[model samples]
Target chain A: MEAFKETLLSSFIVFENQLNGQKKSELHKLRQKAFEAFEKYGFPTRKDEDWKYTNLKPIIKHDYKIFHPKEQKLQLDEARKYFLSETDTYRIVFVDGYYASWLSLTTHHQYDICTFSALINRYPEIADEYVGKLINHGDSFTALNTAFAREGAYIFVPDNKIVDKPIEILHFTTPHALPAFQQPRSLLVLGKNSRATVIERHISLSANPVFTNSATEVFLHTGAILDHYKIQTDHYEASLIDNTVYQLQGYSVLNLTTASLGGKFVRNNPIVKLIESMAEAHLWGLTKIDSSELADHHTSIEHIAPHCQSNELYKGIFGGRSTGIFNGKVYVAPHAQKTNAFQQNNNIVLSDKATVNTKPQLEIFANDVKCSHGCTVGQMDENAMFYLRQRGIAADKARALLLLAFAGEIVDKIQLPELRQYVKRIFNQKNHIDFDFDL
Target chain B: MLKIKNLHVSVDDTPILKGISLEIKKGEIHAIMGPNGSGKSTLSNVIAGKEDYQITQGTIEFEGKDLLELSAEERAHLGIFLSFQYPVEIPGVSVTNFIKTAINENRKAKGLEPMPAKELLKLIRERMELLNMDKSFLSRSLNEGFSGGEKKRNEIFQLSMLQPKLAILDETDSGLDIDALRIVAKGVNTLRTPENAFLIITHYQRLLEYIVPDFVHVLYNGKIVKTGSKDLALALEEKGYDWIKEEVAI
Candidate 1:
């Protein structure tokens, strides 16, 4: 208990030092309020409802230093090889939670690209209104991230403007001597009648066990369209906790996809709030885990306005004694009439020892709504295995072929061809099996 | 080319085949006609090296090699094939890919290179046509969503593609329609050669009309009670299996 208290005090001291140089600004005021919330809540325990399945004692036991702005440079050529080949996109590079302009692509003259540090320094009005608003203060990690978020990326698409290409933000973390903690934040605000695509990738250069606490908040105004893709394929020894919140206004459409193919312990929390009438949101995810890895996904869609619709589908394949957990909840408030919501969580356990725990829930308080949820857990069809083997395919090759087909249903649904192909290559390389035929 | 001597088999400690002996030279077609519990299907499965059946006292030789000492896949590589009575469905694996894997695996076992995709596709198309199977069926998942007739025809199409030296048909005519039966029979007939043999397991004499066999053996109580020419099948059809049991007892 004494060690735990000492760790907490050290973290709070580091957070204070990280915010000491900031001027008396509105952003600093919000950070102060968030810090107060953290001091009151401290850390979530296993008794907390949301943290029951996940234990963060290991994360809190260590004293991790906050990543500071550094003059260190990263090799971009090796990083560019992971991007989609055909997409014409602007690049933003963040090293160790701080934006590095030297590695970023130049933005168009009309468009604006700024770091979270710059936003807090220049656009305090926007930062003051949006920062810490979408986060759940009760969650310890969210509060921690809010209290110490030094720098990240800020993207704003102007009203009535259409960005023809995607904007890629690459977050690269370097190994530190002590247990490092990097909280990279991103806030994408799309004005009315605008359209854009954003791809955020989190990568690590070393296998050291580091903590990546990241958050992305997307606000889509009326009639705006946003395509957000988050790819988390980092070193196997790293641990990541990412929280994404989407707030949609009137008649806006948001499509969010997340793919996690690597990590030792990873958890993704995606929350979508339909704040206005006729808003629609779609969430899809695909994760392939092996070799004792643990991947957890929790998603919630709240329909706060009338005539709103939301759909979510997540598929996972666990092999080699890996464990996967999926919990999806759809909530239709009392006044949100005419709400249509659907959620599905499907998993295939490739080995006998591999396990999956899936729960799909729907809480509908509205009288007139259509909401449904489904969850399934099973193994590869044995008859299918026998048929393939009888046809002369080796046992291992046959199993691999079936696995690809099982995952193809979700991978093929990705609309962006380049992203889909990139994901396919990742899947192929991760599984070490070539899917020669086109999806 | 194939021989079975005193083959006594048991499935889960229950005797299924009792002292059964049979032999077939190259280029000969033999038919084993029996009642429902006479262990007809068990004979084929045992010969193919199925795992569950225990051969208590028996010796099975194919091409002068011990067949029981080989695994099922190894037996397949040595030119033994069984057209299943009920074909298993495999989703997401195309028929062409399945057949190519089989052919290539067998060829590789025989110290030969795998067949190229182009040539393999051409051969599959030719054999599919011979069995009256639709061209599109080759691209679909193997046996998934296939009709009963289509499944039987697919079995024969696979037989034509693999060109196994010893083909064991385990009730291949059970679920096939008349037209499908004719096509499957024609496929089997077209593959016949002086160096290959066949063992047809059936209860009816109708299929014998299409692929005539040189020997017809009446299997009763897990043993051959009578061995005769094609005329015996016609007689059995007229009198039913009861007449054979009565004759054996008398």
Candidate 2:
């Protein structure tokens, strides 16, 4: 713990050395304050209820060095497959903890679609106000990310402006100089009455023990609509801690989904705050684990406004000795009456050694509201398996088909056509099986 | 060409079938009628290689192959089909994809390549038409949200698609209305040929009117007590199994 703190405190020097005098002056105070919070909380242990299933000691114990966005040149041929090449969009690509200009396509259109490091330089006030506002800093990782929140994507949709094309933020970890500890923070502040879609992915080129602490803060103004997706396909040697927070104003709608197929240990914390009436939020996730992998999803929706609604669904499939966890909470403030909230977490343990822990919590002080939550854990239906086999489907293929179908409950909800297909396609490609059903 | 001699089956150490013998030849349709708990469905499951039923003393030969040695899927690959009394519902798996996978797997087991998509589509459309099913039903999830009649009809549709050598219809007439029963029987009749055979296990004789059988056997107390012509089904349907029980008592 002391080593991680000392290393974190020392990285400020390395981070500031790369910046100019003007840029360093703007962010110096905020970094120090954020670092103080990180030092206070240190690393959460198993005794902490939130981190019960996930252990961060293995990741934080490394004698890590601060990562700088280097000038490494990677061929487009190598990194193109990680992208959704069929779709055109404003793409901001980061490689080895550095922004790769040759591989990125940022926009200068009516609304900004660029990098976060650039936002801190170009517009420091907006960056400072919106950066740490919604980030719940009690968590040690969130504080750590805020202390070195120099790298990530910056997405802004101006009021009344509709960006027809989706924005793609692709972060590729190459393990360039050493085992990299990267904190990439993205801030998405959508203007009033605007709508857009954002797709984020973490692709690893080499498996050399990379740990990424990523935080994305989205501010949805009145009547804004955003369809957000995060696809994590890192190698087994890499670990990812993803924290995304969304604050919705009146009459706004936010839909977010996380699809995790790779990474040895993955933890996703998606928090949504509904602050005004008629606002709705849907938080969904799907995790499929095999071998000794582990994936934990923590989701919470805060209803601070009246007549708001929130729904959460998370599903997982575990095999081998893998483990999974889903903890969802829906909180309605006392004044937030008539808030309808629902949550569900379902899982299938295909092996005896696999385990899953699911908890759905709802705290409503309102008198005239409807809230419900359900959870179930079971194995593949033996009757269904036999029925498929009686029709001559091979056992292995039958299992794959049933699993893909089971996952379809969540995959089908993906709105983007290419993104939906890519999610299914990548899962099949990773399993080295063909689940080519016409779903 | 199938033979089940001295077949004794037990599930969870409790005997369900005791000393049952039957022979089915090519081009023959044999119907087995019995009362509740008469082990009619047990016979179909045993023949289909369901693992839960322990075959204590029996030998089932299908076209001179030791059928007991094969798995359920292998039994399917060896041209054995069982139209389940109750079809399983699978969500997100379309009927088209399910059947395509089943047919391709069967072909692969026989060392054949997957059927061409065009050919498979043509075959599916023809079978669906024969079953009097709408084309839209092909896109739906397999048996998910389907009514009992629709589920039974789908069983027949799959029977027509797979076209196995020996087909076993286990209680296929239980949940069907009169109209669905006639259509399903008609599909079965249409698919029947001199080279393939059928073992129809039913509780009522109403289905025998649409599907004329060469013989009807009365299974009582886990044994075939009576084997006679199709007239026996009509007589049993009229007189009920009580008369058979009384005669066996005598």
Candidate 3:
């Protein structure tokens, strides 16, 4: 812990010396505040309630250097297969925590789909209105990410303007002379009566230890709709900590699906706050972990307004000593009448060594609210396996199919057609399924 | 083409079938009728190689091959089909996908490539029509929320699709109404070829009125105690199994 703090603090000093000072004074101040917060908390241990099932001390012990590539030197061909290479969509790509403008296909045609670095440098006033506002302050990793936040996706959808194509944000990290550690921050603002689909993916191009502490703050204006899909299928050597906070206005809808298929150790914190009445949000997560990997999903949905509703479903499959943790909480405030919230987390442990901890927490103060939570940790249904085998599916194939079925429910919720097919292929390959049957 | 000799099967170390023997050749339809708890479903499950049933003492030969040595799916690959008494519900796997996987698996075991998509579609549509099933039924999760009649109809539909050499109907007519019973019976009748046989294990004689059985056997006390022509089912339906128990008492 001391090593990480000293490394980060020294890096910040060097980073301060490099900055010219006059124009970047506000960003420097933000970094100083964030660094102070990180120094107070350090890295969370197993004793913390939120980090009870996830221990990051091992990951923190590594000597990770902050990355700074020269220029936009890589080609789209290098990161072609990682993002939407086939389809035409707005794309923002980053390599080693630096935005690659030459490889990116970002546009300001109807709305702004650009880089956060350029946005923050060009128009810090508009960028500061939303950056680092929605996230909670105490989490050390999130604070650390804020301290070093640089380049990621910055999107803005104009009011009453519907973007026809979805946006793809691909963050590719590769170790150069030193093991790279990245802090990629993304901020998106959707105006009223606008609709857009966004896909954010973290991909590792090389087999090196890359730890990314990323944060994204999304703001949904009234009646805005966003279909967000976060694909965390990184290499086994890569670890990720993603904090995504969404704030919704009245009559807004946010449908989010996250597939965490690969990663050595992953911690995802997605918190949603329904700030106005009649807004709705749906959160879905599917994690398939194996080979001693750990995937933890800590989610919270706060219904602070009357007549708001939220639905959440998180499913996982663990094998070969892999572990999974799902701690989802739903909070309905005192005057949040008629709030309907449902949360479910189901897990299947395929091996004797695999472990899973699932907890669904609901705190409802409104007497007239309808809130329910369901959680289950178990093995695959024996009867279902027998039924599949009776139809001539081999034992291994049957097991794969049942696991696919458990994970496919979330995959089926993906809104993009092309992206859905691509995700299914990824899912099949990750789980060792040979067939290409549709979901 | 199925021969069982001196078969004694037990479930959970408790004997359910005691010294029962039966034989059925191709192109013949045989019916077995008995009261409840007479090991009717047990016999069919045992034939289908259900792991729960232990054949303590038996020899089951199908086409001169020992059937007991094969797994359930291996037995299925050997043209042995058992329409389960209770169809299992499999969520997230559609009925069409389930049947496609089953048929392709059977074909693969026979060293054949997967059937073409168009050909499989044509075959599925034809069999679906024969069973009077809607096209929408194919897209639903397999028996997830199906009614009793719908489940039975699906089983018969699968039977027509597989076209096994020996088909064992274990109480397929239990949950059907008159109309559904007629459709299921007609589906089974249409698939009856000269190279395949049917063993209809049922209680009521109403199903026999649709697809007339060539022979009928009385399953009493875990064994077939009486073998006769189709008239035996009618006699049992009239006499109500009590007389059979009394006559077998001695």
Candidate 4:
């Protein structure tokens, strides 16, 4: 076994022994089962079909300190860079795997908005009923997170409640000396006919090597609506593996958008299951990376019940020897007679050395379902570039305008105006173009 | 203000414009009329600094500077504009936004601050009224899903907005209804000034009836075979280009 894997196993044993009388708890039992699974599978290699294009050798080679992270504090002005400060939101913040109460604005009235550790202590049965119920046992990264990660954001909206304010889950890593490995586990459960919007992000303040293995599970009861956004634009020295799972009941609607400017090595796995009739899932993603950075997104949407619909669109812009990978799958079960699933992946490779690998997979077992998938990998439209340049815009500025226009389609779908502006500001800062569109 | 001497242009080594020369002075409008594949558009594209066409042999001097040595955007900054024959669609950029960017880029090239928001908006609204464009049209994507007439009118709208010193209208009247043509022609006429010139490239003489030109040049087989006054446009419209072809053959 790899030295890092062995260290993780021995550390898990020590951490479990430190639980004291809590070892007999159901959450601890679940953690024990997850540990056994991780022991059997260890970390995934490039040989795994899901990880064929991403190699983890360089990421796991470092001796990361995973068990204990030193306490770190951040001032409001220093940490305000990651928050949507212009808009009012309920915030749950964590620094190096420990909850930061001073920087958070959680609520417990009418609905539950607090940390997982607090929820686990106050409502253990509620935690046991939903904590690891939606994760795939085969995903070893998720199992590793389930075994050790203890603190993250948790929100529960009861039936018929509408949370007008958005909720933000922010995780920042302030590594001390040695390389740090942090895992965060978050969950959101929406009761019947409830509605909410959530924004999640991972940021590192320092230029230290940090590896984050994060997982989030969302359960939408009947008629629940959710608009979720995940922004991943961390430090250049960081590496992140994020796994997100969503299970929708009857008549539930899920709109999730992910914007990744990216880090050294990043991989995103989002699995969505439409388990009941008339559920809808709209998944959109935009990734722009340059200079040897890598961003790989593997998404799956399974239609299990009749009359469910899923629409997926993911766009990528890769430049300066960067590599991007997208593998999206849409599956329709035998009973999903009236299912409608459509997926499209488009990419623009700016440099000759930049590479993009895109694949759209569709497996439909029902004859009456409508399923279509399309993928394209090409460069910037030359005609469009010339069109903009002929209007007194320089070549580089014209290219930036067209690239932003290409990305604007996805950014426009953000329901929140402040959030949309935030994403646009990030796009400008990373690409070095000020595309002011007053209209 | 513009002079071209012994201009020869080729695309992939296939000669498109062969030994063509023309001159245009300020306060004058020159119309280039020809049948399909006569390299009328090629001349305009080369002048606009499109990279696809190679100027095998040519010397184009615009206001005493070597035009061929500059990029397309630099040519634009030097007060040269080409109203594209087919405007490309930019889906997410609105008409107002694109024109604002273009006007500001032109100003930036001249080291001037961007036009203030109120002044720009006033100028844009005035130009839109001249082109008969509704206010809602300014908010839509640049030429995306616009009708043929709307697209032509939009070209004129941009032409009026930029107000270039030398504007080349390449087949601007090809895809337009009679009303749209009249609106576009009126817009052009209103924007005309004694300090700028217009190079109108078209196949028919219908548009010339509205915006009368000072001279008409018949381009045949990549060369200007005939040059006459506005009466020449009427004669060509009446007799068709076969007369010019026979004249060139002789």
Location of the lowest summed lDDT over 10 successive residues in candidate 4 chain B? B148-157
Q: After best superposition, candidate 3 residue B185: deviation in angstroms?
A: 1.6
Query: Is 2 or 3 the stronger prediction by TM-score?
Result: 2
Q: Candidate 4: lDDT of B165?
A: 98
Give me the candidate number with maximum lDDT.
4
Question: Each model's TM-score, in the order given?
Answer: 0.87, 0.96, 0.94, 0.97
Which sequence of candidate numbers ranks them by lDDT, best first?
Answer: 4, 2, 3, 1
Candidate 2: list runs displaced more than 4 Å.
A13-27
lDDT of each: 0.81, 0.87, 0.86, 0.90
Q: Write out the backbone clash pairs for model 4.
A: none
Interface RMSD of each: 2.7, 1.0, 1.5, 1.2
Model 2 global lDDT (CA atoms, 0 to 1)? 0.87
The lDDT, on a scale of 0 to 1, for candidate 4 is 0.90
What DockQ does each prediction reach against the true complex?
0.36, 0.79, 0.58, 0.75
Ten residues in sequence with the least summed lDDT for candidate 3 chain B: B45-54
- All candidates in order of TM-score, best leading: 4, 2, 3, 1
lDDT of 1 by residue, B1-250 (tens): 8889999999889998999999999899999998898999889888876676888998999989999897677778788888888888766567877777778878877889988888987898788778878789978887889998888888888889989889999899988778888998999999999999999999998899999999999999889999999999999999999988998889
Kindly report, for each predicted structure in the order presented, the TM-score of its chain A compared with the true chain A.
0.94, 0.96, 0.96, 0.98
> lDDT tens digits, residues B1-250, model 2?
8999999999899998999999999999999999999999889988987778899998999999989999889999999999999899999999998898899999999999999999999999899888899998989999999999999999999999999999999999998999999999989999999999999999999999999999999999999999999999999988999999999999
Residue pairs whose backbone atoms clash in candidate 3:
none
By summed lDDT, the worst window of 10 consecutive residues in model 3 chain A runs over: A19-28
lDDT of 2 by residue, A1-439 (tens): 5797788777777766766674545456666677788878888999999988877777777766566456575778888887776348778899877888888878867988988878888988888678788987788888889878778999888899998788889988774656777788899999999999899988777657788889989999999999998887778878899999999999999989889887888999999999999999988888888888889998989999999989888888888888898988788899999999989898989999998988876788877888999999999987888888888887787788888888898999898788899889877765567754657
